[model samples]
Target chain A: MGPDGSRPEPPDNPPSSEDTQRNAGARGRPGAGHILPVNRADIPFLAALGVVASVYIVLIAGIVLAKVFYVQLPLVGEVFTNPGYRYAVVLSLVSCSITTILSVWIAVPTAYLMTRVEFPGKRIVDAMLDIPIVLPPLVIGLGLLMLFQTPPGAFVQQYVTFTYAIPGVILAQFMVACAFAVRTMMAAFAEINPRQEQVAVTLGCTRAQAFWMVVLPEARRGMIPAATIAWARAMGEFGPVLVFAGTTRMRTEVMPTTIFLELQVGNLGMAAAVAAVMLALSLIVLILMRLAGHGRMF
Target chain B: MIHFDNITIRLDGFALENINLHIPTGAYAVLMGRTGCGKTTILEAACGLRPIESGRIHLMGRDVTDMPPGRRNVGLVPQDGALFTTMTVEQQLGFALRVRHRPKGEIAARARELAEWLGIGHLLHRRPHGLSGGERQRVAIGRALAAHPDILCLDEPLSALDEETHGGMLDLLRHVHEDTGVTVLHITHNRREARALAQSLIIMRGGRFLEGETARGQLAREEDDA
Candidate 1:
C-alpha cells in the first residue's frame, strides 16, 4: 500500500517468482530479478514454514544473546582463568581439529562411493551411513563401549587406548561428526554435474586425474561449509563426550563437559559463562555459514 | 577411424541395438536423427562413457571396446559446449596437455595455436560464461582438438546458433576438417547442416541405421517429425 492510502499499482515489470524461489533471504537475490513490490497478502502458504523457522531461530538467538549479556564479565574471566578451563580449551581445540580432519578424510571417499558406484548394497550402505544422525548420541556412546568389549575392539582399546581416555573423545567426536560430514559432502557431490568430469576424461585425463583437477576444485565451495559445520558439531558435542570420556578434569574435559561439570557442582555463573562461550562460538559459525554457505564464495 | 560392429547399448528401458558403422580416417561424417533416436547415446558409447551390451568398438585399428575414455584418442564437443566454468578459455584448451604433464611452454604454444585456428584466440583469457554461444562452441571444439586426437565427435554443437553464426560454424567445421584432417562425426537433425557439413551421412532411427539409397528421404522425414 502507498503512503497516500490509494490502492497501489503492481510493480513495473514485476519479476517472476522463479529467481527468488530457491534463495530464502532477499539480499542475495540477483539484481534484475528483484525490485518487484511484494504484497503481504500474496505470500504463499509454504512461506509459513519459513516464517516459523525464522521466528524459532530469532527467539533462540535472542534468548541466548540476552543470557550471554547477563553474565558478569569477571565471572566469565574467573571461569576462563581456571586451570581446568585452560586444559579444556587446549584439549577441545586438539581433539575437535583432529575429529574434523578425520571426518573429512572419511567423508570424501564415502560420498564419492555413494555418488559414483552402483553396487549390490549401495542403498543399504547409504542408509547405514545416516544411522548416526537418527540415533541418539548416548546410544552411540553405549555402542562404542559395548564394541570395545569384543576381541578386535579390545585390541583397539589396549593398543590405541581410545576408551575412557583423550583419544576416546576424539573417537566419539569422529563417529558423530563424520556422519554429518558424509551427508554434507554427499549433498555437495550430488549438486555437481558429473558431465564436467566426463568431459575432462574425454580430454586426455584419467578418471582420478579428472576428479582431482576438476571435481575437487569445483567442490571447494561445498567442502568449506561441510568442514565448518562438522567442526562446529564436533566442538559442541556433549552426550557422547561425557559418556565415553567420563569428563575427567584436565584430561578429556572439552568445553561442553566443562559446562556440565560446572553445573553439576552448582557453580551457575561459571556454567553460564562456559555456556555463553560455546554459544558465542556457535553464533560465529552460523554467521560464517550465512556469509559463505549455499555455494556462495567466501 | 572408428568401427562399431553390432553394438548394443541399454539405457533404462530403451535400448539402442545392433548398430554397425565404419567411419574411415579423415572423413567428416554427420549422423542425423530425431530427438530420442539415440544419437548422443551412440556418441557416448563410442567414447567409452557408456558400456555397450554387445560387440566391439575399434578406433585407429585398435580395439577400444573395453578401454576407458581417456585412452581412446577420441575427443568430444558436447551439446551446449559443456565448457568448464572454473577455467578461462586458454586453460580449457590446454587442459588435455596439462593432464599429460606436458611442459608449460609446449602446452601454451599448442593452446594459442589451436585458439587461433578455431577463431577464438581473442577469447583466450575470458571465462566460459563471458563468451557468446558461438564463441563457447568454438572454444569447445578447440579444447577437444588440443590433444590432437585422431577423431573428433561433435554433438549438435551448432544447434543453438543463429542463422548467421550457423553458417559461420559450418564454415569453421569445414575449415577444421580440411586443416587437421581429423575424422569427424557430427550429430545434427537439421538437413541444412547435414547438406552443408556432411561429406558422408548416416541416418539413425529408433536404434538402427537407415541404410541404402532411401536414407536421405528417411532423414528428411525424421527431421520433419522432430
Candidate 2:
C-alpha cells in the first residue's frame, strides 16, 4: 500500500478484456458494462408510487375538464363581450405583469442575501419572510387592512390611495406573490455552488460585481419560474383584492374578482366561464414553469 | 509574498487556531494535511473568502485583514475548478478583466493568449458543463491567471485528474510558476505533488501547522538528492 496505510491508486493502463469480464462478473452480471440491472423487487414499490401520484394528477385534470365542459362556448363569448369582464381582464393582465416584475426584483436580492449571508436572528427573519406563504389569504388581506389603518399606512395613503384602488390590488398581489417568488429564488440560489462567487471575488470582482456577473447569470433560469409563479398567483389573488381593494366593477376588479362578482350576482354560467379562463392561464403558467425547471414544476 | 500571522477562523465547532505561515515571493509552496485539518481554511482566509476572528494577512507587504477579496490581488482555483457553469471557457478567462473594466480589445487578447497557453484554445467556445476534468482545470487556471495577480492559490487542483492528466497538470503548473514568477500556495495531500513542485513545504494537523523545521528538512533533503 506504498507505506501510506491507504490503498494504492490503480495503474494508468486500460483494463484487459479478461479483467473487464472479471470485474463485470464480480458485479453479478457479465458484459453489463455501465448499464445498471434493474431489480424485479423494485417494481411493486415503483408501481405503488406511480399509482399514488396519478390520483392527484387525475383529480386536477378531472376538475379542469369538468369546468371546460360545463362552460358553454356561448357563455364564454358572452363573458368576454361584457365590458366589465373585458376591463377586469385588462386590469388583471396589467397588474399581474407589474406585480411579477416587482416580485422578481425584490426576490432576487432577498434570496441572494438569505442564501449567502449569515447574521443573528437569521432563522427568525427567514420565518417572518415565509409568513405570507403560510398565513391564510383572508388573514393577509385583513392584516393589510389593519396595517393601512395605522399612522405609517395612513401617512402613505395621504400621498397615494391604496385602499380600494388599483394600486392596492397590485400591492395585495405583490405581498403574497413576492413571497412565492422569494421561495423559488432561494431554492435556485441554494442549488448553485457559492464557490463560483467566491472564486469571482478572488478574481478581482467586488461583491456586487460578482453577483451581477456570476450569481445573477447562474440564477437567471430560476427567475423564469419565479416570475411565472408570481404572475399566476397575482392572477388568482381574490381575498386580498376583495378585502384591500374592495372589488369595484371596472375599477379594482381582476380575473379572480370577476369570478367572485359573477357569483355574487347568482350568475353561475359567467363564474364558470371566468373559472375556465383562469384554469387556462394556470395551465399556461404550469407549462412555463415545467419548461423552466426542465420538466420539474417546482 | 503571502503572510498569515496568528490567524484564527472558527466554523460550526471546528477552528483553525493561531495559524502562522509565510511563502516568499516567487516561491511555490505546497501545504499537505489530512482531510478537515484546515488546509483549505488557510487558503480561504488568505484569499479573504473567510473572515479571520483575530490576526492579520499581508499580501505583498500590505496588511489585508479588513480588505475585501477583490482588492487583495490574489487568484484562487477552488476544488474541482468551480468554473462558472454559465460562461464559456473564453468568457471565464476574461471574467476578471471584464469586472475590472479593462478595455474590450485587451480582454479579448489576454483571453486568447491565456487560452492558447493553457492549451484550451479549441475549447474556448464550449462551456464548463461537458469539459473533462483536466480541461476544466486548465480553463480554471487560465481564468485565475487572466488578471495577473500577485499570488495564486490552488486547492486540490489536481486531485480529480487521472494519472496522465495529473502528470500533465504538474508540468503545466511548473511551467506556469516559472513563466509568471507568481507566488503559489497549493494544497494537496499527495507527497508526490509536494515533492515534484514545492519550493517550500508546510504540513498541518489538528487545525495547526506542524514544526516548520521537519518540513524544511524534508525539502532540503529532496533538494540535496536532486
- Estimated TM-score per prediction? 0.88, 0.88
Error of 2 at A268 (Å): 1.7
True contacts kept of each: 0.41, 0.54
| Residue B7 lDDT, candidate 1, scale 0-100 | 92
**Chain B TM-score, one value per candidate, order as shown:** 0.95, 0.94
Q: Worst 10-residue stretch by lDDT in candidate 1 chain A?
A: A1-10
- Estimate, for each residue in B108-153, the C-alpha lDDT of model 2 and write its tens digit: 9999999888878878898875566678788889999998999999
Tens-digit per-residue lDDT, A233-283, candidate 2: 998888888999998998999988888878989998889998887777778
- Residues B1-226 of candidate 1 have per-residue lDDT tens digits of 8899999889888997788999899999899888988899999998889999999999999999998899999889988777776788999999999989999999999999988777667778987654566787788888999899999999998886656567778888898899999999999988889988887789986666864456777766766897
RMSD of 1: 7.0
lDDT of 2 at A260: 83
- The reply for model 2, stretches above 4 Å from the true place, is A1-38, A285-298, B211-213, B216-226
The runs of at least 3 residues in candidate 1 whose Cα sits more than 4 Å from the true structure, single-residue gaps closed, are A1-54, A284-298, B160-164, B222-226
lDDT string, candidate 1, A147-195, tens digits: 8889999987777887789989998998899999998888777666677
Error of 2 at A247 (Å): 2.3
Scored by CA lDDT, what does every candidate get? Answer: 0.80, 0.84
**What's the distance in Å from true for residue A116, model 2?**
0.7
* Candidate 1 clash figure, as a count: 0
In terms of DockQ, the best-performing candidate is: 2
